[model samples]
Target: MIEKIEDIKRIELSQFKFPVNVYLIDDLLIDTGFPRTAKKLLSYLKNKKINKIVNTHGHMDHTGGNSLLQGYFRCRIYHYPAKRSYTVVEKLLFGNLKNFTSETPPEKINTDNYSFEILYTPGHSDDHITLFEKKKRYIFSGDLVLHGEAREVSRDVKIYRAIESLKKLRTLRPEKIFPGHGEIFYGYEVLDEKIGYLEDLGERILRLYEGGKSVKEIVKIVFGGERFPYFFIKGYFSCENLVRSYIKDPKSL
Candidate 1:
């Protein structure tokens, strides 16, 4: 059991323990999994009827199955209007580096079966979006919100945007949050946790900056301990970038 939520179907694929949830409702398939898992997904939907496939964002993991799924089902793909250019960049990067090419430019969603209100939450990525169902009070938060461990917003622009988006989401008072990379959260506590984590990190970075510590020095002091993974060195550098960016605009902290 990969922790299935109401009104959503869960499918575990490969080594990724966090299974992808496909929201099935009246012929709509929201957010397909990575390309490597397409075969299993196709098998799952073989006899089932589907109308359209919509993505909460344009991350490769989210839209990697697009081309393959379209080849079989020939269904229309829908996503937020903001992800178009990012989708193109993703296609270009994957196209040049990988043998498989499964990228499809999605269309803007405008339907009646399910009404969606979009929140431009750009922290995990510049083009991130969360979809809210007004009637159900359910949010398909791609990466803006997560259930476990805080996410890094590498860029200052994205961090500011994420804060704005989170503030906007606070108004919704959503009952449940279906995130892209984790288990669904039951209440608004998850939102507060995310905010608190970011705020703490921001404050620490600001204090280190005020103490005249170089980014590398701060990285060693703050996260160079054994608690942090060795592989996260690059991520630490990204966080340094965030720190530098925040230095330029202290309001972000």
Candidate 2:
């Protein structure tokens, strides 16, 4: 079932535990959830008149429902023109390969509604973009700013970019945030928190590197104490990427 939060509605789909938020403005649907959850989403949309569809970004979990939604609504899908190819490859790699297939490049998305501006905040991925809706004072931040425990598991270049992106977002002064993977936050405080976390991690890794620590050693030190083994690999990967980023440019911290 989809829970309505003010003007936005969200549906938690499947056991994948994917949280797909569907923002609505009367007849317009801002985003569609994962493709594997298309049937349920379609059923929910059957009663509404959906004329426009846009994605926050092009990750598989976010764009997975695009093809089926396009077939059902027969409407143009809008996404950042600059990020289309990257989004496509990302979906192909992580989406349910057997069930969801790719589509042609997405057409350019341009709108006159000055209510929101697309901020190119690449960190999580080079194609990442954040939608700042001034009217609502909310930002539809796609994986660039995560709530709860923050993770920095991307290419070193991307991690640096992500930090830069977060800095850019801090300037927006958004009152709230709707992220891709977690609960909505009340204010920009979360952004500051994430930035601090990344900065601190970067500094720690730099210190370890100065002490002749390898990525493997640092990963163990940073995350070996965590109780959940599930996070070991991801934490290690993130540390490795940070280490690489630090090596490339010590000033990134």
Candidate 3:
């Protein structure tokens, strides 16, 4: 599905129940959804001009099509450097990130009329970023702000950083958030919802810790324990990760 929000073209490249969106503005593409969906994305943009590609981060779901799309268009690919290497499971599931040539994306990218400011807002991942169109008050939040509460974070996620990033964006007061997953959200309701949930969750976690609840017990009580597919990821993505982050940095909120 393709929807136009003023000058931006949002392409739902992933057919998953929870989709990943790739935004296109003029010759620049915000993200490339997945490796398997590259052909589909390519066919969709066969005639469209693509001279540059900017990935919000190095995650496979976001950068999977990088090699193919860049090979095809010979466009320069820009992204923030990955803070860490991909996990074994990540490599198995979505392949490794390669062909990203630029570590520093321009602070601002300009099209014929619109301008987007690249904001380094990590937490979801150390390299995660959001694209902000200041005049329009629109934020292309790349996994920095999801639709619901952030209960279980992946192993690499820094809960403290995530909270700080949320606080930063909250100050921006975005009117609309084009998230990496889920539908576009209007106003600050969803953003505030996530921030509130995470903050409350952290306090609850701290209290539980003070009560002498072990991380395992805390996970069970707070998040029902890591379940199903989370276990399949070899604890790389789990509730324990979230608990650990806060336990390690209680003063960071």
Candidate 4:
């Protein structure tokens, strides 16, 4: 379904366990939901003009429909340029990226009414970015801001970097957030909650590490035990990955 917010239109493509959202502003489309849901996305924008595409990140859920949309609209796509390759498991989960090559977007994106500052907010992933319209204080926070606490993270997630990105967003004090997943939320309370949780978690992990507690012991003590879904994801998202993040980048603590 499509919901209008001012001049922007939000297309909610997936409503599963992890919901996916894509936004449209003027001729620009921010983040494609998934390759499987590309048809629905196309249907919503059938009567609209989408000349440009900008992705918040390269994750499958976010960029799955890139190839299809670009081919259909013959539009240019933009993303933060990175030099990393995906793992076999990552490809299996996030889907193939096809031959889509995105140029680097400018510091600001100017549409008919609003001009968005492309903030390089990399926490969820190194190539992650968030679009901000300073005048309206609106943020298109990809995976950087979610509704719930991020207890488990994937292998590529740098918790310290995520914390820093959250802090950066907090400084903006955005009035409303158009997230990559979930609903359009108001205020910075969710950002605060995530920052506080990560900071506290980092401190605790640092303390446990200083006390010679192994990652295994830390995960057990902090999270109690591995819950469902972690085993199924091949340990891609786990408390242990969160614990190791501090070890990898302890200076942040």
In terms of TM-score, which candidate is strongest? 3
List candidate 3 stretches off by more than 4 Å.
15-18, 82-84, 96-100, 229-232, 250-253
Positional deviation of residue 97's Cα in model 2 after best superposition, in angstroms: 6.2
Minimal lDDT window, size 10, model 4: 225-234
Residue 174, model 2, lDDT: 88
Mark the 10 consecutive residues where model 2 has the least summed lDDT. 97-106
State the C-alpha lDDT per candidate.
0.62, 0.65, 0.82, 0.83
The per-residue C-alpha lDDT of model 2 at residue 209 equals 80
As for TM-score, the candidate ahead, 2 or 4, is 4
- Expressed as tens digits, the lDDT of each residue in 1-253 for candidate 3 is 9999887899997645547889988999988988778889999988888988888887778887877888788888778863336777787666566654555688988877678999999888888888888999989888888866776667778888888898899899899998887689899777778888888998999999999999999999998877745455747767888898888854653
Q: What lDDT tens digits, residue by residue, belong to model 4 across residues 1-253?
A: 7889887889888724556999999999999987678778887777788888889988878887887888788888998873336667667666666667578989999888888999998878889999999999999999998877666777768888888898999999999999998889899887888888888888988899999999989988988866645454646767788788888854763
lDDT of 1 by residue, 95-174 (tens): 31122222333323434466666666775666566778888787778767765544333342456556667767778988
Q: How many backbone clashes does candidate 3 have?
A: 0
Q: Where is model 1 more than 4 Å wrong at Cα?
A: 1-4, 14-21, 82-113, 151-157, 225-253
Error of 2 at 233 (Å): 8.5
The prediction achieving the highest lDDT against the true structure is 4
Displacement of the residue 111 alpha carbon in candidate 2, Å: 9.3
TM-score of 2: 0.78
- TM-score of each predicted structure versus truth: 0.76, 0.78, 0.92, 0.91
